[model samples]
Target: MARDLEFGDFTPAEKRRITALTARMVLPRANLTRLRRQVEDIEQQAERRKKK
Candidate 1:
């Protein structure tokens, strides 16, 4: 069986709280993966700008 996920709109304070909580819950491996992805994205953008 599949379940549908519910999404809600968050106020600025609520958004900040949720982000802080999530950051606390993130594992080191997951954090490393996120940093690698961000670095790759930045590098790709730099390469594109260089080609322009």
Candidate 2:
């Protein structure tokens, strides 16, 4: 079975890499505002979890 991984499980470097890849997922001409909003949402969740 595949292991379930959470965002917090990654090292700082890995997290950065993940963010870079996520951004590149959109086409060069695609709408970026939507993607940025989604990424920000996930980041906020990570921050909230860290505070708990």
Candidate 3:
């Protein structure tokens, strides 16, 4: 089954790759904003779980 991704799931190199890809995109600004928000949400969720 497919699973949701958490921020901690990505390695530092992977995170850099994601950022690079996101930055090189020619998509609409709203779409890029949404992607950033999604990443923030994933990180937040991971942080909450880690605190438990």
lDDT of 2 at 31: 62
Which prediction has more favorable lDDT, 1 or 2? 2
User: Global lDDT for candidate 3?
Assistant: 0.58
Q: Point out where model 3 deviates above 4 Å.
A: 1-30
Query: In model 1, where do residues sit more than 4 Å from their true spots?
Result: 1-30
Best by TM-score: 2
Per-residue lDDT tens digits of candidate 2, residues 1-52? 0134466655586578557757676778756776666666556655555557
What is the total number of backbone clashes in candidate 2? 0
Ranking by TM-score: 2, 3, 1
Per-candidate TM-score against the hidden true structure: 0.42, 0.51, 0.45
The TM-score of predicted model 1 comes to 0.42
The 0-to-1 C-alpha lDDT of every candidate, in the order given, reads 0.46, 0.61, 0.58
